[model samples]
Target chain A: MAVEIVMPKLGWTAEEATITEWTKKDGELVQRGEVYLLVEGDKSVNEIESFETAILRLLPDGPKVGETVKIGTLLGYFVQPGERAPFEAAQMMATQAQSAPSVTADAPSLSTVDPDPYAGRDKRGPKISPRALRVANELGVDWQKLTGSGTSGRIVEADVQAAAAAAVAAKVAVVQAPPAQPVAAQVIAPAPAPPIARATPAAGNATRKTIAQRMSQSAHTTAPVTLTTEVDASEVFKLREAIKGDAKRSGVSSVPSYNDIFAKLVALALQEHPALNASWTDEGVLQHAHTNIGMAVQTERGLLVPVLRNPAAKSLTVIATEAAQLVERARNGNISGDEMRSGTFTITNLGMYDVDGFTPIINLPECAILGLGRMVAKVVVIDEATEKTAIRKMMTLSLTFDHRVVDGAPAAQFLQRIKQFVEQPYLWLTR
Target chain B: MKELTYTVAAREALDEEMARDPRIFVMGEGIGKRGGNFNTTLGLYEKYGPTRLCDTPISERGFVGLAVGAAMSGSIPVIDFMMVDFILDAMGEIINQMAKMQYMSSGRLRMPMVLRGCIGIGGAAATHHSGSYYSIFSNIPGLRVIVPTTPADVKGMFRTALRGNDPVIMLEHKNLLSNKGPVPDGDYTTPFGQARIARAGKHVTAVGVALTVQKCLQAADQLAKQGIEVEVIDPRSTSPLDIATILQSVKKTGRLMIVDDAFEPCGFGAEVSAQVGTHGFDDLDAPIRRLSGAFAPTPYSPPLENEIVPSVERIAAALGELVKE
Candidate 1:
């Protein structure tokens, strides 16, 4: 029996993701829990792990960077000892959607709706979902008209719901409904009216059409959870400077970023907190055997997360070289589909854009995501007894996870492990 | 192996390559039985039949894309866009797709394609056709760019391009096609990444490519009569630019003047001048003089076009000025 690999749903609003790199070759026999590929989605790169033990048989074709592969297409095939093929709900949905005609051909066009749910989400900019934007767009409701009610005044579903209800009521009051003469009102409600185009320039720039579908699927099917914490990066800064002269002597250009150290720390932490590095299914929790870390790259086309496989196994120099090459390829538009389909966990750093902190969307089914913030220098009073003040680097770490599988204590402990690694990064070398 | 004219040399490259390799073919407007607008493919249609010597619609975008797709599929395609300015119409395929295809594919596929276009100003080609735009393609990566100043080079470079694995933009000077030289009477391939010293000198190193290389040679002859030893370097390939030869010449001369028919800003002259200033600045006795086309599009009037771009007189004056400095 051959199993077709479909595009994985990442969040409530993410419809599609860019393939970053393939960890396993097409002919390689993959164990159920082994890391398979990397995807750039939800503004971060994530490692997609194998769900079943099988051989990867095929790879899809598309542009390296900007081409958007529709969901449910065959990423590859898997042969097994089974008598029949397993049901791929995602692949079926994608095919049925492709073959069957759309509902709202004559209705208002949704062509202008931003395709990417994570569109307009700069590290320091507004965080809005593709769903909320779509609903707002469908009814010609202006996003600027509704005040945000979520964290940091981000417009959530409720805001869209409120706007939709208000529009519905206004329509009911002004326009009279005609006497019923049709067989049914459901079909007449308007085949999914082509999404409406929002007038905002920011919305136009970041819309990913595939992002909308995956996000809708994730929200409808998966349970989401989030966790948050504060991590001090004072020591990370010190260690980076300490290695600068050494890097120069070795002919390397610059020191690895704090995010580089944090990526390694997160990988180490996931090993100890295996629960956080897994997928929750009806059968059981799938714990990944190898850690493939995905780094989020914000490109001109959209957000693509390319993964760095077994980052923990490689030295910092190798990690730096791989990371730089992956980022460049993603920008140059050369990543493959197998690379974007499978990922275990994700990390998104907004420090380069000077943002303080943010709630990153969970790349779905996967347990958690790490959100990094700008590292700011602050004065700290080390001891009240001595009355001595010390300057240190401080930053916020936000972890959004599915609480159904992981408890708060375990999540905190995992974060603490990450903090320890960040503080004493040289310990990674010893390991 | 026959006596091929500069134009015929190009036609033979298409004819011989198409005859030798089934994968090789020619596609361009008016390049079929009608020959080429410039007679570069004068007799290819009857020889190879229409399928191999295909005539394309006057759509630069469509033909460039077709050529790109053919190259990706392992076919050797010789695409003639008629004029270099026509390349601007298909810039998306040329720069975005063709230039980055190899690197983007992680070295998976090689684009074995050749883009032939006529450049330089003459015959009242107007604003659209009269352009010396070699710098535009040279500055970009993944494209092996070359400028052939003589009849022999046009044949040799085209032969090389037909055989090499990389995509090549063969910049043919409109003014130099008829100016014949003692070309080899047999199959020949001029290796890319090599610079030719047209004239040997010691006072200053003067460099140019394409029609401007000829201008520099003429300028060198005029200056030589006045006891000025001027070295003229023609870097046939611009992208795999023979910077070593250019720098070596500059290092010996202690002064330099780059004469080119292209504009000064972001032009090849500016690049050469900067390279000399940064790489061999210590060896300089005077500031580098860059005599280039005026910062304007090539005009329609022959006199105006001639005035805007570098001429033999302007190049000689620039060389004289460098010596005086």
Candidate 2:
């Protein structure tokens, strides 16, 4: 028999839960009592365990990451040795709902998806039930011959039996070592004269699609301007060196990466310039107290900005250690979408890639974003009194602020404060 | 090149290999006169005569043991187990002796024997006869599992099997016996662990073996009309799977789905799915899908029997999901 893996009804008031990550993918065998998936409800992430040992079949178009699906939704199925999923019509509809852009369709962000038959999913891969497999094996059933009426065209046991009975009635294919496979081939290999096109870009995943919509919204709605400034990063570099040594002596286990500096110092600057740490909402400009700095990391999955909560309050080493773990989790695709949401501001560094300066769009709902460029040694005038020039470590900081909430002057003042903190790391401790 | 059925192509491979190697011999039930169960060895009996083509009693363990001993001695013996399902009759000899003897012998002895049979669910032959066990046989250490999808592929792979110096088990799909296609003339051998692209498309790479290959192609065709292109790959052999071919195809297509005529759990589809999931993950835009045989018994009733086999509609549906916007 098969077990129904439904969305858990966490609390009486909780209406839905979002599936964070499926620890075990579909078609993988899972043992009883083992956590096979993770779901988030009421801000708490829960590992969902399998009640029985079985082969898993996840609903293909089901709730993706960041999608908050209703409770009791058919998340997937777990079939023991040889059992078929017992999903009814309503549950089937819920599974097929993923066929529609489950993320963009309901988000109200993208109004109408381009109506190309090419836009949505088309019929190609078969979804055969366990009973269907054995029945096909028992009767030498050709899988391609039957169309499933099940959810997303899954081949139920009934469909297999109907296909076999229909074949027997057709007289073309019957019980035997398939008489003259030429006749059988007619049923199996339909006229595959040629293909339409061999190369089309696969549909973008849910996360990337969400990123696209949000970025588009941010670009379309916000009146943003970027202010660039070159600051002497010598003090920040020395600070990093001292911290690394202190971390080594204190057994801190984590010497913060250079990016962690932006998370730390930019967060401190936001605390002083509270106007910069605010969002331009429809109601009014909402200011925030906690300085949660989103740190963006690039991965093949996509660009993920995991929020480092209260970076200003936490020690540099603590922020660095947590940022490292969050980045790893984000890269490994296990970090929850919640970790990416609700940031007061964002700090992205392209210094490692040797990029000088590039304007960064504000992550939606956040008022400003700070982009850190590569720190390079350049000959510069240190003192005009003696006309002295020296080689100093310098980096370009590009801060894009929402003009709707803050004017150019305040934005520049915010940038200067960051520059001041960058030029002298000792000021933050003294303040 | 000559147009030939899967049966005749398999026979030609046997005939040509035996003519090339005088030490090769054939043994099975009704193979000498009645032309074996599926007619793959129809004419070899008359052409090679009794010594080279001998029909044995239905004692699977006895004849299989003899074939292994014969292989250990010198001659290359190609034995047939009427049905892969009936292989249970000689499980001890096949799983233990024939599969492990070479490893134990080290460099001293070799077992260049072949166990040929028809696999896959078909003919409403009930549970006992219609069985697809390629995934099970692939688990053994010393066996090279080769499953051919087309007449041309069967001709090429069977020759490759005949030439290899290991215990090669070649499975012929029951539904494809009469399927006809162009077979290349003269010395041709389809290399093992190399996948064949049955059909090419841009969207999804759907891999199938033997019977399912045809299903994938058919599904690909249906998807093409709908403007969703699906690339179909046939890893002609399973044990030494041509994962590179699959990976390259996936790298191009950005999505992968495997169709196995066997059961889903620990089936050919599951193993291949696991392999690509780990290695070709970054290249994929969608999660890997496996359209495997239902994990139920091969039932007696035709309707119930057909339920377990993955079909064209299912393949196209899986591709549809993979190609979804």
Candidate 3:
């Protein structure tokens, strides 16, 4: 008896579905409970598992990818070896190919299988067990994208354990990306650099494609506003000098960089001005509890922001140490997606290029981004009564916010607090 | 190598320890003069004299407490229970006082006592005489539980337990007393937490303690003939079980079977399966299988008793089903 695989009614209302992929070939040996093919309903894509163990024999009239068939229509059959095909040739050409994004609402979606099993899976994502699911969920592994190798091809607890080991391997792989040599190279080459062409067609690079899609998404959905302000950086320079001297006196090798100090101060300022530490949602605003700041680093691949979490709660030294490591890894291209995502706020510094604060785009879903410009010595009018003139350091701060989430005043207040910290970096150290 | 019965191996370990040290002694009901009901302490009574082999009345609680006191006073005492079923009578002395003595004394006092008992079902011993209580006792913090499956392990682990300065519960299976195997003439101690591979196979890893190890080896041997490779591991000591060996074997085999003489729930097999499931699940191809003594008390009928306890037939059949997956 050939077990008929019908087009299942995925939801109460959904009837006809398109057979998007065939996991097993027509004559492949198939086992019960093994995922055999994928069918797309209006609301969901269900991976169809075999109900009986037998050789899979697709009817010549079986539906193909992009062809929508009626509910209860036969998709394929599981037949005994040497069994004859019951149907003759039936090809219904696709009227239109409509491929929707497969990610499910609230729940994570899994594609059943393709003729090529690895076709739909993320090369970097891990397949794990149920307990491993909990472990990966805790350790932050995006599991649904992984292809499993467990019994009947389902992630098991051991797979999760292996995923943890795999996660370490992934991190080590990222770290092996050409080390700080590039960082040194970038610093040494002070040529009149042409702006890196953002729209140059790279042949078959998937990362560039993804970056284009993400940037388009941000630009499409966000109501972005850019605000720029110049702050007195004399106090910040003196604070950095004191920190460097104290660190040298104590035999500390790494002193807090200006970016590290700003990142820490911005996180704390965001904490005080909670309106900026949020995400845009249809239901309401998602007020994030922790201050995870993503610092944008230009990598060999593209611009990547490696997030350092809870920067507001961390000490200045800790922030400097962690931020330095994150930037180094980002540059090396060894940073995991888990480290790249989970950001509530972001900071991009072009101060290194002597950029006088260009309008950096908001890393969308996050409310705002703060851009730091190069600090330079300038003549300032001091002692207003005597009309005396003296030298003072100044830097530009550009804050880009999602205007829909926060109004001008709160955004301005958040930037002002950041400005106050920039003027008096020692105020944060005392706290 | 000398072929010795399990009983003779145990007696030899005690005799060797007693002769080597003046403070070493044996105390249990009907152990002296009669030389133990199972004859495991047969010649120890005569060799050590009445003072060293002081047999007590049928009072496990009192005798166990007195032995704990003897251990506290710098004597290495070996206390035997006529049957593991009666261990409940001395739970306070064994679990609370003796198990907690060293920690309570802040390491000042060392209770080097060995509470030896016979477990496992056969001979229609019924519920009272047949009980695998080591798993229950192994739960205590300060106590180390050991079960020897062969003459070699019996002799070796016995020597280790007798010499070490910690409370060790040595559970010898009643049915294995008459079984014999080759034992080395010289002194050798099998370290705790080290598992011995009795028969190596590739399809599944089977773990057993005490007599179940023998049964699993027999099963493994039979399975090998059927073209199914089964790896049999004997965790000579249960409490500090040789889980690493089991996990490694499972990593290779991806299938696991545990044969135990203890009841299924919370038994040594269950614990081993759990640890492997938590830590080695990635290596597992199928759910862990545990073949243990039935939850019911050992029936008085010999056939029924044999049916309840894990057997080679049951172990092989379980592995056969597992291999099919």
Best by TM-score: 3
Computed on C-alpha atoms, the DockQ of candidate 2 is 0.01
Candidate 3 local lDDT, A1-431, one digit each (tens):
66777888878887688887786777666678988888888756799887777877777766777899889998777777455345421221111112444435764333321124343254324434444455554554545556666444656545555666676555444432322344434444469778787676664365555555556556656788889999998988998899899999999978888878888888889889989998776535656656889898887788888898888788878988998898898888777888887788889999889999788787766889999999988888888899998889988999999888899999999899888888887677677
True contacts kept of each: 0.00, 0.00, 0.00
TM-score of 3: 0.47
Model 1 score (lDDT) = 0.74
Candidates ranked by lDDT, best first? Answer: 2, 3, 1
Error of 2 at A301 (Å): 52
What TM-score fits each model? 0.43, 0.45, 0.47
- The digit string of per-residue lDDT tens for model 1 on A1-431 reads 57677667777777777777677765555778988778778678888898898766554442243334555545666765221223333454556568755757775555433244343243223444444554554444556557666444656445777887776554432321221224123323457777698555554243353344344444444466556656667778887887787888888784666666766778877888898887665435656656777777777667777777877777776777777877788777787644554556788889778887687776654678888888888887878999998888888787877676677788888877877776676666578
lDDT of 3 at B301: 92
What is each model's TM-score for chain A? 0.52, 0.53, 0.53
lDDT of 3 by residue, B162-229 (tens): 88889999999987888999998897888988888888888888888888888888888888889999
lDDT of 2 by residue, B1-325 (tens): 8899999999999999999999899888888888888887887788889888888988889999999999999989998776877777888998899999988888477888999988889888877888877888899888899998888888888888778779898888889999999998889888888888888888778888888888888888888899988888888899898888988997777667888888888788888888887887656555678888777778888887777788788778877976662
**Superposed Cα RMSD, model 3:** 17.8
Q: Let me know the TM-score candidate 1 reaches against the reference structure.
A: 0.43
Looking at candidate 3 chain B, the ten consecutive residues that score lowest on lDDT are: B281-290
Which regions of candidate 2 fall more than 4 Å away from where they truly are? A1-431
